[model samples]
Target: MIIFLRRKMSRSKECLMKYNSKKALLVTGERKLKNTSEKLFSELKVSPFYLNQLSEVLPFLSRENVDIIIFGSDTYQTQKETFSELLQTVSLNYPQSESIILARENDVPFVVSVLKFGSTHYIKYPVGIKELQSLMKSAMATQPAISPRLEKEPGKDSSRFGLIMGKSTKMQQVYAQMRHAAMTDIPVLLIGETGTGKDLAAQTIHQQSERSAQEYLPVNLGSLPNELVASELFGHEKGSFTGATHQHIGVFERATEGTVFLDEIDSVDEKVQISLLRLLEQKKFNRLGGKKTIKTDARIIAASNENLEELLRKGQFRQDLYYRLDVFRITMPPLREKIEDIPMLIEDFLTRFNKLFNKKVKKLDPECLEVLQAYNWPGNVRELKNIIQRAVLLAEGDRLYIHNLPPRLQKTRRSAHSISFRIGTPLDQIEKEVIKETLALTHNNRTQAAKLLGITRRALYNKLNKHKLK
Candidate 1:
C-alpha cells in the first residue's frame, strides 16, 4: 500500500511539473491595454508580466524564463527603430522568448516586415478569445526559439494540403476543424448551405484521412429517387427490383476501407435514416434484397444545407442518425459568410477557367468586384465559380467587366460605409458600432457582415442582440 501511495505521489508530482503555467510578458504604453491583456492572459492560464516600454523588457526577459513577449503596435510603431533594436538585442541575449506583435487589421505591410525580421505571428486587433488561444497555443506549444518566423511562400498548391485557399478567419476555423476531424475515422457531418463547398470539404477530409489511398464515393441523397435510394446506397441483388437485372455494388460496400460522402443527407427519408443509424452504430449493413451481412470500415461524411435539428422536429430526419453523424460536425460558412475570400476564390477560379478556355482575362473591374461583394450569394461558392467561369469565357479584354455578368449580378447598389475609431471611444462601443456599420454596409446581411468583421455568424448575432443594434 505504501509502494502504491509512493507511485501515485510520483505521478502526481510529474503531472504538476508538466502543468507549469507558461509565462507571458506584455510590453505596451497604454493602461487600457493592461486590463485587456490581464483578461486574455488569465483566460489562457498563463503567468503574465507587464512593462510600460520596450526598454524595460530586456531586464525582465533575462530574469524570468518568459515564454513569449507581446509588443503592442501602438507602442512598437512609435519607435520602430528602438523596438527593432530591442527585439534584436533580446534575440541575441535571451535566445528563448518568442516575440509577437499586436497589430490592428490595417497593419499588413508592417506585419509582413516584422515577420521577416524574426517576430512571430501577428495577433490582430479585436482579438477574440478563441483567436488568441489558437494563435498562442500554436506559438507557445512549439519551440519558442527555433521555428522559422515567416509565412509560407506564395506559390502554394491550389488546395494547400487539402485546404481551400483563403486566409480569412472563417476559413481558418473551417480548416482547423477539418484538420482535427481528419485525424479520426469518427463520422463527420458538414453543415453548410448548398454550393458552399461542403462536398469539397468532404473530399478534402477523405483525402487527408488515413483512407486517402482508397476510393472516395460521394452520393447525393437529394438527387436520388426515393424508391431507389436504399438500393443505390446499400446495394441490390439480381432480380431484387423491377429494373434490377444484375447484382450491383452499393456506395457503402464500394467505399469499404475508404469514405462515403452523403451530400444533402437531410433530404433522406426516415427509412433511409434508419438504415443509416444501423450503419453508423454497427458499421454493418445488408444489401437491399440479400440476406448476407456486409461490414465496412468506410468513414461516413454527411452534409446538409438545411438544419437537421429542424428536420428532426418535423419528423423528416432521424434523431438517432442525426446524433450519430453529429460526432464531429463542422459548419461550412456560405460564400456570403466569407465575402472577404471572394477575391481569392475569384483568382483561383479565374486562373483555372482561363487555362481551360484559352482566355487571358487578367483582372476584374474594380466596380465589378464591389458589386459582387455587396450582393448576397444564395448558391454560395458554386454560384460564384460559375459566374467567374462564364465571365472568363465571355470577357474579350484583359479585365472582366460588369456587363459580362448576368443582370442579377450587375444589380444591387449598397452605399458603402467607412469604419474609423476615435481616441476616447470605449472599446465595447467601438466594437458595437463596427458591427452595426458592417451590417449597414452589407445592407443588413448578417452573414456578409460577419465575414467582414472577422467573426462567426453566431457571434455576430449575439453581439447584435447584445448591443441592441437591430
Candidate 2:
C-alpha cells in the first residue's frame, strides 16, 4: 500500500512538470491585449511572461525558456525594422520557439512579408476567444521549422501546386502543409467546407508523395449506401451476402502500396468506423465474411466537408477514428477567405471552357468582374467555374458582359428600399405599413397583396377595413 502511494505521487509530479514546461511570452504595451493574453494563457495552462518594450525581450528570453512569442501589431507597425531584427534573433538563437503576430485582416501583405523572416504564423485581430484559442493551440502543437516553405523559383510558377491553384498567403500556407504531409506516410485529415478544393488537395498530396508510382483511388463515402460502405472499403468473400455472387476486391486491397483518398468521410457509419480504426492502428483488416486478416501498405487520406471535431463532440463520429486520421491535418481555406485568388481562378476557368466550347471569349467586362468580386461565393471555386461556363455559352461576342452573368450576379447593387422602424413602434402600425407597401406594389390588387402578406383574402379585407385602407 505504501509503495503504491509513493508511485502515484511520483506520477502526479511528472505530469505537473510536463505541463509546466510549455511557456509563452507576450511583448505588448496595450492593456486590452495584455488582458486577452492573460486570459488565453491561463486557459491553455501555459506559463506566460510579458514585457512592455522590445529591448527587454532578448535579455529576458535568453535568461528564461519561452516556447511562443506574440508581437502586438500596434507596436510592431511602428518598429518594423526592430521587429524584423528580433525575429532573426529568435530564429537563430531559439529556433524551437515559434513567433506569432497579432495583426488586422488588412495587414495580410505585411504578415506574408514577415513570414519569410522565420515567423511561424499570424492571428487576425478582433478574434473571438474560442476561435483564437483554437488557432493558438494548433500553432503551439505544430513545428513550423520542419514544415516545407515552398517559394516560387526563378523559372517555376508558385501560384499553383499540382492541380490546386492560388497565390494568396492562405493558399501558400496550405501548399506548405501539403508538402509536409507528402513527406510522411502517416494518415492525413483534410477539413473544410464544401467546394474548397479538398479533392484536389488529396490528389496533390498523393502525387507529390513517394506513392506517386502506385495507383491513386478516390472513394466518395457519402455517395455509397451506408450498408455497403464497409464492403466497398474491405473486400467481401463469395457468398457473403445476397448480392455477393462472386469474390469482391475493395479499394484498400487494390490500392496496396498506393494512396486511397476517402472523400466525405464524415458520412461513414459506426460499423465502418470500427474497421477503419483497426486498419489505421494495425495496417490490416479482415474482408467481409472472411477469416483471414489482409495486410495493406496503402496510405489513407480522409476529407470531410463538415467539422469532424463538432461531430465527435456530438457523439456522431468515433473519437478513436477521428484521432487516428488527425495525425496530420490540413484545412483548405474557403473561397471567401482567399478572395484575392479569385481573379486568377476566373482566368483559368475561362481558358479551359473557351477551348472546350470553341469560343473566342477574350476577357470579362469590368462590370461583370466587379459583380463577381463583390458577391460572396457560397459554392466557392466550383460555383465560379459553373458560372463562367454558363457565361461562355451565352456570350455572343469576343468579350463576356455583365448581361451574360446569372441574374443573381448581374445585379451589382440592390435598389429595394429598406424599411426601418423605431424600437417603440406598435406591431399593428408596422403591419399596416407593410400591407400598404404590398398593396402599392401590387397596384391596389387585394388578391396579390393578400398572397404577398401570406394571408387569406378575408383576413386582408378585415385588416384593410379595420385600418380604413379601403
Candidate 3:
C-alpha cells in the first residue's frame, strides 16, 4: 500500500510540473502599451506582467518558462539599451522561446529590422485583442523547431530609422504602400503636410528594404543656403571655394548602398535640381571645382510639403526632376482624416513621456479625451504628441484632467451651454440624438460613432434600438 501511495504522489508531481510550465506572456512598456496589453491579456484569459524595462523583470524571465514575449517600441529609448541587450540574451539563453515585438505601424519596419537582428517577429500596435490572441496562439503552435541564424553581426550598430504610429484603416492603406515601396530600389517622393511625418515614412521604407544595412543620410533642402546647397550635396574639393578648407564627402557619397532623404526637395534651386537630375539618371557627379566624376549608388527618397505638380506648373520646381523623383509616391494623410487613431496615438505618447519624465500617470479623464477628439489637430501627429507630453508634465494626479491641458485645448472644451437638449428629451432620446449627430458628422459610420461615444459596437447597437432609431 505504501508503494502504491508513492507512485500516485509521483504522478501528481508530474502533472503539477506540466501545469507550471505553461506560460502565456509578459508585456513590458510604459503606461500606454501596458494598459492595452493588459486589456488584451484579460480578454484572452492570459496573465501578463507589465514592466517599464526588461531589467526589472529579468528575474521573472529567468525563472518563469514564458511561452511568449511582447515588447513595446518604447524599449528602444536613448537611455535604455537593456531591452536590446535582453533580446540578444534571450535568444542565446532560450533559443526555443518565441519573441514578438509590438510597435506603431510607422515603426514596424524599424522594429522588424532590429528584432530580425535577433531573429524575432514584430506586430504593429493598436492590434485588436482577438487578433493578438490569435497571433499568440499561432506563435505558440508554430514554434520553430530549430533556431534561425542571427542576421546582424555583433558589435555593429543598427542605423536609426523613423517611426509611423497608427492602426486606423486609412493608416493601414498607407502602410501597404510603404511595404510595396520597400520591395524595390525606386526613388520615392513623399508629399504631406508639415507634421505628417514624411521623414518618418521615408526612413521606415529604407529600414524595411534590402538596403537597410547601408547608411541613411538626410539633407534638408529648405534649410540649406543657395550658395551652399551645391557644395553640401556634391561635396567640395580642397580650396574649391572660400570655406573649402578641407575635402568633404556629400550626402550622396556618404549614402552609397543606402538612401539619401532630401527634405523639402521643392526648395532646391534650379541649378541644384539639374545636378540632382543628372545624379538620378547617370548615378554620377563631380565635386565642386573638381574634374573627377564620382559614382554613387544611393537610393533617393525626397519629401515636400508643397504640391510639386503645382510648383512645376508655376515654374518653381523642375518638371523633369519631379518625374525622376516621382517613380514611387506615398502621401501621408493628415491627422484629422484619421481621428479614430487619436486614442492609440495619445496612449503611445503618454507611455513614452511617462517613461521619459519618470511619472506613473494612470489615465486620461474621459472629458479630457472627449475635448481632444472634438478639436482639429491642424499640425497632425507631431502636434498631438507635443500636447500630450506637455499635459503629462503639468498633470497633478494619476489621471490627466481637462484643466491640465493647454489653454487652447481647455478653451475648446465643451461648455454647459453647448450641451444639446429638448424640453421632453428622454435619456434614450438624448443618446439617440447624440449618436445620430455623431454619425452624421462621421458620415453615417457606426464604428466611428461608437469610438466617439467611447463604447463598443454592441453597446452602440443596443442604444440605437432602445431609442427606436434602428
Candidate 4:
C-alpha cells in the first residue's frame, strides 16, 4: 500500500480535491493496482473513476471532462495497439487531458513504447506519497484552462471563428473541424465551391494553430503561369531561367517553420503535383534551378474550388498527391446552403463596409432583404460581400434599398414580398403592413417570422400587439 501523509502535501487538500472533482480516470486490469491507486488518491482526498478495460476508457473520455488519464503498465503491455490508438485520440481531440503511464522499476520495455507515443508522464511503483501527489499536481498544471470566450454560445458575439463567421449548423461543423485542423501540423485540404470561404478557413486554421507565430504565406496556384508554378513554389537560382535574374526564395523556403496556403490547388499541372507530393512526403525539395535539397518545416494547407476527387478519377490530379493532402479535409458550405446565416452575415458586412465606406447604412429595406435571402448565392459569401460593399457605397440614405443593389438581384425581388407606401404614410402604418406581409410569408410561424424580420420572438409579439395584427 502506498502511504500518503496528508499534512506533508505541498498543496492544500481542498485544492487537490477541487482538481480531482473535475475528474480523472484510472485504468488497469489488475484489481490490486486499482485498489492501491484508489487508496493513494483517497488518502489525498481525491477520488478517480476506475476502468478495467482500454475499450471503456475511450467512451468515458469522450463523455466526461477527463483531466488526467492514468493507465497501468500492465494495461499497456497487454493492449499495446489499443493504448497507442487511445493516446493518439487524446492528443488530437482532447488535448487538455494529461496522459500518465504507471509503470514498475523493471518496465524498460514499457518506457521504450511510451517514448514513441510522445511526451507522457509516468510514475514508477514504490513512488513516495509525496511524489504521487506532486505528479498529480504537475499533470493538472499542464492542462490548459478553457477560454471564457469559447464557453459562450456560438451565435453570440463569439460566433466569429478567426475570420470566418457563421452560426449555422454546417458552419459550426466547419468551425469544429477547423479547430481540429489547427491542433496539429497535418496537411489540411479545404474543399468548397468558389467564394465558400476556403481561403479564409485555411488562414483561420493557421491563425489558430501552433504555427500562428510563423509566417503565413498564401499562393494562388491558378493565378500563376503554367511554366512559372514550379519556380514560384520552390524558388529559383540566379540565372536559372529566362526571368531568374536573381536568386528568389519560394513559398516553401520562405515559409519554413510556418504555413503555406495553396489556393486553387486543382490548377497545379502534373509536374507541380509531383514536386508537391515529394515535398509532402520528405519536407525537402530543391529549388527550380538549385540542386541542393533544402529541408523546411512548413505546414501545407491546400484549398480547391473544383472537385479534386473527380480530377483524380480523370487523371488530372495525381492520386498519391491527393491522398497526402487529404489528411484533414474541411469542406466549406456554400452560402445558399446556410441561408439562415444571411442576416447575421449581412450585419457583419454592414459593420465592416460601414467603416470602410464611411457610411452608416443601418438596415436593408424589407424587399432588399427578401431578395438577397431568396437569391441562390452562386458566388457564395464573396459575392454577398461584394454586393454589400457596392450597396454601401451607393446607399444614399440610412437604409439600404433595392435600387442600391445590382439589377440581377433586383430581378429576384418578389412582388408579394414587396410593400408599397406613400411618401407621407405614418411610420406606424408602414410597420403594421411590414409585419402583416412577413407573417403571410412565414404562414404565421412567429418564430421564423421573428427571425426573418430580425427581432426576438418577444419583440415580435409586442409589435403584433401594438399593430393589432396578432
Residue-level lDDT for 136 in candidate 3: 72
What lDDT is reached at residue 87 by model 1? 65
Q: Which stretches of candidate 4 lie over 4 Å from their true place?
A: 1-158, 418-470
Residue 103 of model 3 has an lDDT of 70
Q: What shift in Å separates residue 68 of candidate 1 from its native position after superposition?
A: 15
Q: How accurate is candidate 4 locally (lDDT)?
A: 0.78
lDDT of 1 at 172: 63
Clashing pairs in 2: none
lDDT score, candidate 1: 0.74
Residue 226 lDDT in model 4?
96
lDDT tens readout by residue for model 3, 397-451: 7889988888887876545214569788888677767888776554565765687
**Tens-digit lDDT track for model 4 on 1-470?**
22111111122334434433556788887887776777777765655788887888766765665667787777777667777777765654454466777767677555546544433677777566577767877766544443222222323443678899997767867776776577567899999999999888888888887678899999999999999999889999999989789998999999999999999999999999999999999999999879899999999999998988899889999999999999889889888667689999999999999999899989998778887876777898999999999999999889998899999888766675778998999999999998898777655667657777888789999999998776
Error of 4 at 398 (Å): 0.8
Estimate every model's Cα lDDT from 0 to 1: 0.74, 0.77, 0.72, 0.78
Give the C-alpha miss distance for residue 337 in model 1, angstroms: 2.0
Candidate 3: list runs displaced more than 4 Å.
Answer: 1-162, 416-418, 423-470
Question: Clash pairs of candidate 4?
Answer: none
TM-score preference between candidates 2 and 3, better one = 2
**Model 4: which ten-residue window has the lowest total lDDT?**
1-10
The lDDT ranking, best first, is: 4, 2, 1, 3
| C-alpha root-mean-square deviation, candidate 2 | 14.9
